[model samples]
Target: MAEFHQSRKNIIRLIFIGVFAVIAMRLFYLQVIETKYRQLANAQAIVRKLIYPTRGIIYDRHGRVVVNNTALYDLMVTPSEVKHLDTAFLCELLGIDTATFRERMEKIIIRNSRYRQSVFAELLPPDVYGRIEENLYQFPGFELVERPVRNYPYHAGAHIFGYIGEVDSATIRRSDGFYQAGDFIGKTGLERSYEDVLRGQRGVTYLVRDSRNRIQGSYAGGMYDTPAVAGKNLYLSLDIELQQLGEQLLQNKIGSIVAIDPNTGGILAMVSSPTYDPNELSGSERNKKFSRLFTNPELPLFNRPIQATYPPGSTFKPVDALIALHEGVITPQYGYDCRGVYLGCGRPIKCTESFPGHASNLYNAIAYSCNSYFSQVFRFIVDRERRPALGLAEWYRYVSDFGLGKKLGIDLPGEYSGYIPDTAHYNKIFGKGHWNSCTIVSLGIGQGEITETPLQLANVMCIIANHGYYYTPHVVDSVEGDPDFYRTHLVLHRITANVSDTDYDIVTRAMAAVVERGTATIAAIPGITICGKTGTAQNFTIINGKRVELKDHSLFAAFAPREHPKIAIAVVVENAGFGASWAAPIASLMIEKYLRDSIATDRLPLLKRISEANLIPEYILEKKRRIDSLNQVRDKLEARRIVAR
Candidate 1:
């Protein structure tokens, strides 16, 4: 019985031992047979990252950088993975308080995809990047990503340079299948205009993630990644040096300077005062800095060249003359009496000049900036029947043909359509048929609802320079890629009208008179034969419900090389008294500097004086002095009255 039991036990032991041997053999086979698969799985569990592409560069016509990329670090955080992250240390490193950190984290959690780790913050500066990157291992949830932010090489063209900010929910909704959340987009100016051409295709890489959400290895040996095609470069027609100079000229003023090539309508320089530095609104501190700028009283974000409108002043006279001449309402030989004031319009509108009973013809009238002559001519053109004025309806039509009272459809974004009051406009204000040409007669002199942007004033000058045609003003001369693109995109803008050759000659002669012997004598560029017009418009200072007189806005518009025009410019100095004093000289200097490529050193003294001069509130000064005088008189009168009583 014992021997039988031992045999059975041996058999059982053998059966159990055989089963163990079979299991071990199977395990060995599986480990060795699937070695390649196991190796791939293990490798994928370790190291993988996705890389974004670099943005393209923006250059000026001279290949100088206008907008370029600067490297910045993005602070990426994965909330769940940040188990033992040093919150205080991280906040200190990033220059953020705990409340801000918490708020940002909450926003990131809400906005990010649940399937992937989130990008909490972006565009951290180098100093912040250095601090956090050193202790990256200590924060498992956070990582550093390097990318490019837009940088302007030159500080000029602030309004035209525009800015880039992170895409919001509104932008995402209106993205039109182009962008995703958290992308930066151009908010204004040419940056907004050419966003598609400037921002290139984005590439992506497939990164494997484990259950713990740690990156593994590249999927499919990097075959799944698509290389980013870099964005195409933009070559703007801006002369950076000239643009900087223009900005310097308009410093601390509430006006603009627009310089354009009359031939090509290529904007050379567009400067508006109170401009903020482009770099100030870039990257991490963008929101804070931009908020301050946006709420600024002077309106730095306002593009005074195209967006801000003011009376064309004397600058609109040339356009008025052209329209009058084209309509054959007046002859060059036609004369008007300049008694230093206009009296026929039932109002004593005073003239700036000291002309006494001077019988001025077309040339003399323009040269002297005779208000009486223009007022007579305007009344003749609008209200006359036989050789009569064309009336407001026809007049408005002609002006609209010149691209007035409408957006010029410029390439840059945010061009404002200036207001031109017509008969209908009068109806809105004083009821239909309640007002006539006499009510709005000041429009003839570039006041009373006759407003235009600096860009429009420049365009008007270009029209006169070209004898009626102008190319639609644009900043980009050429785009990268095929030569066909440049050929197709570069377009010329010309006006189709019934302007007679004789009329153009007559207007040119009048403008020539302005430079040869007119109010614009200060604009004479030695031998440049520059034709210009000066304007001083009466503006009101309304305070405490009183309309008080203030120093007028001075304006000057000119085209250089009278015979063969190269550049057309428009300058405005706000409340700087006469156009000759402030606006004309600056316009002349810029013309000489640009056309001749060098300006006279002797003129620097004059320009430097202008640079130092301030445009203060004239009414304030006048009121203070007037009150003192009135008080003295009142005291004397009271003493006399008291003695009599």
Candidate 2:
């Protein structure tokens, strides 16, 4: 019996030892080798919540709000946490039907993980969000996330303040995980150019959840939580009043106007006709309205100021004169016989300025816009070199310094580099050294293969106003952080030519003469010293195997108070009869408005006339009619949707 008792004690000790070893191994596995299981269990009890940051506010030069923010709510769901809920009631609250609800749930399951959160409904306005929040606790897995959506107070500058949209797969891939699938991003214009600074930084928070998935407040007493940083605001140089006035002047016309502060190279106003209210691209009906506007036949989406290109026409004569003076090919006293026509290059170039001073001298030629004198001067500059190609290339260098034929590097997207014809291009088309100065003399008057956008033309005026230098024309004047934001981006460009201050003075004087007594006299202001040039660009295109001519494009470029210039402007009106009639007056009025902040009672009729004038061609009108018809359907649908809510 004593031997049996000893055996029992040994067996009991061994069994206890074996049980302890097993327990130790299991504890080690749970702590190290099989750690993922612990994390999974933690995830079930702890909620990781994202904190969104507000996008930047945009202000005009005078501290007026251009873009602001309004609060909106998004409905979120975790499919795995969802249980038996009132589907019909939820769908009605979210403004979705039964079919839509089913489709969304299926998409969540197929496209996203069941454990991860997904957006069920997006962009609910304050009213809708307030109503839905009262009944949200009734649903088990539903949550609300607050976001700040864009709001436009004035409802102008649609293209300037591009709309934000959800990020696509391509965007996410390009973002390097910085942006997820549903994150909002700027699509174009200033919004796109300053996205990094304007998007700010996101934050995160951790909260505990009960067995029923109800929030139990901050986890770890908020020790690990981070607060979101709001985006930096932008102070723009644009004058909203001036911009609105310009838009009104350009109404019913298919063109653009660009006004810049000559001293700072800050854009004062930029107007593209056929523009839409920016608010239409914001708020609840944004996507639907955007679809209709995107497909409109008039192409209101096109940003014309920096994108549309045209020949500079008579306005180019000033540059030609400057080039000739700089090269010593011609002097200020240079004169040529002008009988209102140019008969040199096997073609008769006609001119409307048959007045007495048309051929007297350089100043008179420029003021009167005498095509013949400029054509002769252009030939002199080109033929100065033995080889015509060499002379043309030399001339091109001067024009290129004025920021033509290249992007101005403005803080906007989709700027086109206007075309500048080169010797190689000419030689390839017309053989080596076969083309002479007379062959392409049309270039002297800003025609042929040369083209310029209104923004570039306006910069040319800014350069002239500054007497040979310019800061790159930019819209944003200052940013919140980094006081050197504007200065760092400001490009101070100087002309690479031997142009003298006297030459600019002489040019400014002649430009003043243009408004004083020449073709652009209609643009004269009572007290302001206005300098301007009128331009009529010939429109030529091939039709039915023959070149056909359309109505001329009216254009003008000007600056005010020639001594200490404040504003420089360029306006182009498509299919208008004369620059003096349409473009000149418009530019003049804009200059006056910017300087005096009021238009004289006398100019009211001119403003009314230009505003009411319809310059779109018949074909464009017919297409617009079709777009209008389709938009009627969209309007009805939008109304019904509003009533349904």
Candidate 3:
């Protein structure tokens, strides 16, 4: 009995020892085998970081920096580290209020984990950095991380340079590569046009940290980290000096100024008045004041040169003349009797001319901007009986060829293809029974339901200057890092804008006559052949429940060195009556400035001092009365009030 009991106790002890050994071995296997992965996970929690690449620089043709990058710090926060942080001290240091700080924290909490970091402040200016650096320890969760912010150096072309802002949610969902939350992208202009070239490839850096979550140094001394590739520099086709002059010329006006190289179709200057500084939109405060400008009733944000559509006025007459000449509808000597009126449907269409009915040849018709001549020509077009039954159809075809009623396919964003009513379009509106050539006779003088962009108007002028051929008007000369820099990458469309040479010369001669002995005498620049046409587009507006026709929208389209045209320009001064009075002088000044280069304008001082001659005595006083009266009377009144006091 005693021997059997001892055997049972020995067996029990052996079983207990076996169980203990198995447990120890399993614990040893787990600690030794899984150590590597645990170390990696720990390292990731402390030191993983992303580095964004800097955007490319934008340069003018002269290699002058128009847009560049500046180093800025993004203040970030780790939510878990916010513990024991001084909230008021942090708010004061970062120039943010308590409510803003709380809101930002709440947003971060909702979007990110307590263990991860979130961007709390962006675009910390140098002065703000100085203040924050002084109180770094007070904000335990905050970190200053370096990033590049866009900068504009020259302030040359604000509208064309565009601006960048943080990528919106819509942009991210639509885009695929190299973009994440907190990334900036081009919002407009060339920046938006060539975002891929400007935004370079991003790089990554691996780091090591202590057990307490402090970065020690780069892992393997950054061997695994690739440096960010800098963006390719871009050289634009814009002449900075010329762009400045155009902007200066358009000051105090609510219109656009678009100048293009007639030969190359490269835009020299595209100015929209009431422009905001692009520098205003480059930084974090962008959202604060931009809404005001963008929403202004004048629509300063609108790029008027390409976006706003208005009646081309008589600037469009050249297109009619060209089409008529090309189609052989009117000969160079095709004369019309302008008894100061045009008989639309055999009803007299009134003209600005005076006298008991005079016959005007084509040359005189253009010089006089004769309504009767163009009315007859338009009737001859839409009145198929006068030509072919398809003359109106063919006229529409030529109008489309001129790029009216279509987008010119310019590089700028938000270009509008202004309305050009076709037969079908008229049918839709008038139900096919209500309209005819006489129904839209005002179109003969660039009125009626016809509409066009300033760019399209300029292109028409360019076609006239080319005498037949026109290149597609473009703003982007070339992309960055393309072959043979500085040469404008000509983007001539596959469809060549070609017209009959004989027809072109006929219109050219008529335009030359306009500057010489016709309505646009104000556009004459000595020593340079400038062919121009003036337009007075009567603008009807209702005032106090009555429809009144304001004097006109002053307009002029001209080309210089008529034999070999270099530049073609179109100027529209809104509500400034009479093209010859306001628009002609501006066009003439621009032409003189272009050809004679400041020396031509040097003659202006002598002209201004001619005491014996006041060619526009009433006009000058009437125009300046509102401008001069304000300062002169205000100054005297202020002085008198002060004396009385």
Q: What is the C-alpha lDDT of each candidate?
A: 0.75, 0.86, 0.73
- For residue 208, what is the lDDT in candidate 3? 79
Q: What is the lDDT of candidate 2?
A: 0.86
Per-residue accuracy of model 2 over 454-542 as CA lDDT, tens digit each:
99999999888889999988999999987998778787999988599988888888999999988898899998888888998987656
Candidate 2: stretches off by over 4 Å: 1-44, 95-112, 125-131, 540-549, 631-645
Native-vs-model 3 lDDT? 0.73
Where model 3 places Cα greater than 4 Å from the true spot, the runs are 1-45, 48-50, 109-117, 209-215, 346-348, 355-359, 386-389, 484-489, 493-498, 540-551, 603-645
Tens digits of lDDT, candidate 3, 1-645: 999999999999999998999988877876777665555465354554557788888776567777899888888787766768788777766666688988988877776555456578887878888888888867766777788878877565777877777876678778864565567887788788778788887776777776665678988888888887878877676666666666666665666778788888888777776567677877766775476566454556778888877787777777888877766678888888667866657777777674532335777778778777888888767775643225556777878877788988777678899987777776677765567777767777788878888788888888788766677787766666687532544645422435678878888888898899888886777778888888877666565799976556778888888988888888876667778876777777667666666636465753333212222223334545664566568769866754553
**Candidate 1: segments with Cα more than 4 A from true spot:** 1-50, 207-217, 356-359, 386-390, 430-434, 482-490, 541-549, 616-645
Q: How accurate locally is residue 146 in candidate 3, as Cα lDDT from 0 to 100? A: 80
Q: List the residue pairs that clash in candidate 1.
A: 44-216, 314-535, 367-518, 381-389, 382-389, 384-388, 471-493
TM-score of 1: 0.84
Give residue 30's error in model 3 in angstroms.
Answer: 10
Task: Mark the 10 consecutive residues where model 2 has the least summed lDDT.
Answer: 109-118
Candidates sorted on lDDT, descending: 2, 1, 3
